[model samples]
Target: LAKTTQPISMDSYEGQEVNITCSHNNIATNDYITWYQQFPSQGPRFIIQGYKTKVTNEVASLFIPADRKSSTLSLPRVSLSDTAVYYCLVGVLSGGAQKLVFGQGTRLTINP
Candidate 1:
């Protein structure tokens, strides 16, 4: 299984864009990479998922390379409300169960 590492924290100003990158050099064949976002007192919400190439939604974009060793999350025009912890996870879904283990995430602080 692949393990991920990211910065412990980051700082950004409101209306600026932010990009958080995670490194996972040993991703497994059955594993699918996913990203999540969590506020102060809330559970992490699914942001995006991708096996390879790019996947984008309203909130973020995920980019994966051919080696699958790393991925990047891009948030455009972030705001103060966007301050939160971002997690990168790798696992497989089985029997309709999504069991994921989250690593120590990147804490993003959006400044005014």
Candidate 2:
């Protein structure tokens, strides 16, 4: 399994952009890195996924280095409501009796 590490917390002001980087020094060949965003009481929503290079969506952008050891999540014009926990995960999706495990994520506080 590929283990990831990220900041425990970050502070950002409203209407500004925020970027959180995660490191996975031992990423495996079968593992694909994915990012998730979670609000107060809701389950995390998928932000982006990339095996290599960059991938962007309407909510955020993900940039992965060539070695696939690290990735970054970028949020544009973040608002107070965007204050939440961001998680970077590296694993393979499984069927049958498999379940996904989450890590201690980066808490982003958007101050107004």
Q: Against the true structure, whose lDDT is highest?
A: 1
TM-score of predicted structure 2: 0.84
- Range of the 10 consecutive residues with the lowest summed lDDT in candidate 2: 92-101
lDDT of 2 at 64: 89
lDDT of 1: 0.84
Native-structure RMSD, model 1: 3.8
lDDT (0-100) at residue 35 of candidate 1? 94
- Residue 32 CA displacement from its true place in model 2, Å: 1.6
Q: Which stretches of candidate 2 lie over 4 Å from their true place?
A: 92-101
Off by over 4 Å in 1: 92-100
The residue-level lDDT of candidate 2 at 77 comes to: 93
Give TM per candidate.
Answer: 0.86, 0.84
